[model samples]
Target: MPHDDVTTPSVTTEQNNQEVLDVFGKHRDLASLPVTENDMPIGLINRAIFMSQMSKPYHRELYNRKSCIAFMDKEPLVVDAAMSIEALTFKAVEYGEKALADGFIIARDGRFLGIGHGLQLMRVVADMQAEKNRQIMHSIDYASTIQRSMLRPSREALARTLDDAGLVWEPRDVVGGDFYHFAAFEDGWFAALADCTGHGVPGAFLTLISSSILTQAIEQRGPRDPGALLMAVNRGIKQMLGQLDGNDETPGSNDGMDAAFFWFDNASRRLAFAGAKSALFVLQPGDEEGEIVDGERMGVGYVDTDLDFTWQNRFVQTQPGSVVFVTTDGLIDQIGGPKEIAFGKRRIRETIRGSRHASAARINEAVLDQYRAWQGHHRRRDDLTFFCFRVQ
Candidate 1:
């Protein structure tokens, strides 16, 4: 009778190999080998190597007659548990074709506790990378949530300033450079759409900077005059970048925002809107006719624009049920659906017009649905955002 070891699982090494094969079977980069107490590996076996060996008479004889110990290679590569992935991979690669075997064994006090397989070791490293990304994402989410709270309420929140009101926001990455906020200032609700210079990390930083300035300006002054708020924000951002003194040629690059803002007065049923670089779309009541305010673009410090960068204020007096759409560049920039085409502004206009009667939430959903359909097999390259509301 043979004495059984309690520490070891009852399953045989071959069974363990089979189980490993079943799970990581598709990983061509992996391989397994038998180990010996002498610190030498007997026969080197990979999926390819084993298949070839099985077909040969000489190799079978070699395998059957010799104690796996007889074929042991004197010097086996081993590593500690704390070895960096770079070192582990380098060591694995050092074995050349034999590197596919179980990864470096983790030993403590001169005893083997466990083994790290190639795929699993790589996964461990990947998990660390994923965790870091999650932390970054959480930070961004927090910042955006805080900024959103500072936004003014929608015009519909008061009287019937707009027939309907809603906001649409989608981030390309975990965080986006485009953002929108709503606030009830003097008489009506004030809203804004901001597109910073970049997206993701760089753009997110600029947006925070711009958002803070905007909030402070609003709190200190008021949203009565949209142009004044923007100008103050522009100057604040310039000052932060030390470019407010007119020395455009500096060591670092310029940081600025392209934005549009509107103030809807519920009392007098008047609407005041101003834009830096963003455009506006309005759907008139009881008519299929649409209006596109080709209003001039606005620029902050360090950014250049030729299309009437001056801030122009526009007004519209209306009854209930008028829909207005404002958006950042993200939604229109989505790449590829059928033939990998951009979801251009034209497509957006049609979608909005078609869903004009839908609720704010439904309209938002419809726009995203159109975008997704257009981006069939393609992925979202940038953040997708839009604001839809009807004057009540």
Candidate 2:
């Protein structure tokens, strides 16, 4: 509650001691009365102290007739009316034990408002903190449910779609910016991994928009050509976000995504890939090191409408035992290790070579284990996602 609601008696500095005593007599519960000048508090007079002074021999005779200011404490605890209960409690503690016992005065615009009890402020702050924590926990639980709904795919459907596959997805928060999508097309199969502009709730919202655009692009244009599919999705994202006319001088919404898309052909044993500032790694059978299929350097949304922003597709002929891996930059960009450096693309390549003969699931686990070992006790810097598939 605001201090205005707890107003108590106030006296002027010119008022005599008897007048202040009369105020205490009328209101038996009053502990302290503020002595004011021009509506501003100048001091405070405690009832017990005043009564003790009066009980002394000739104390009343020596000073009863003088102004109450003589008996008032010149330095008193004062706070603003607009101050929050939590802040007031902190201020009360800073004034030490004696000031807290006497209570503190509240003022607004240099005028007296009321007095607040330190104990009362503590109780209110405790109750508010409890309620706030409860509300936050409830909201996080709801968000986790929604995020799972968007991310998880059926196990049977996943098995039917690929000969062997592994996936690792870890969000920096309960809800995150990184997400993946997969669908079976008439000609082949399409899969995509994306990292939206930010993290947590804001980034999670962009993932929804990007996912919707991607699904629409695949349904309308089909996923036969990876480059064309990405181009169409980029246009759709720009139009949906109203960034078609964006430029360097007056750019449209700066929010967009970095994504990698893959189309696998069952009949030809071929993989077609396109990306927006993302990359794909291929480890062919008998090769000691994996190779990177670099995607387009530009990201999806901030490109100028007048410029030709065409994405190019890269195709690789896969053998029966070839492995293809796609991942967001989160893994390579994470900061940790003895040198406190990024995990880097070099480490990723080495991990793939080391786990070349393992099953897809084992390979995924191995990579994750290496990443965790590199990070040690450091907190994750961003969301992490990886997708791997072995050709039949």
Using all chains and alpha carbons, the TM-scores for the candidates as numbered come to 0.64, 0.77
Clashing pairs in 2: none
User: TM-score of predicted model 2?
Assistant: 0.77
lDDT of 2: 0.82
Error of 2 at 222 (Å): 0.8
Best by lDDT: 2
True lDDT of residue 345, candidate 1: 87
For residues 254-291, could you state the per-residue lDDT of candidate 2 as single tens digits? 77788898888888978889998999999999887768
For candidate 2, what is the total of clashing residue pairs? Answer: 0
Candidate lDDT values, in order = 0.65, 0.82
In candidate 1, stretches whose alpha carbon ends up further than 4 angstroms from where it belongs are: 1-127, 130-163, 242-252, 301-309, 317-319, 357-361
Highest TM-score among the candidates is held by which one? 2
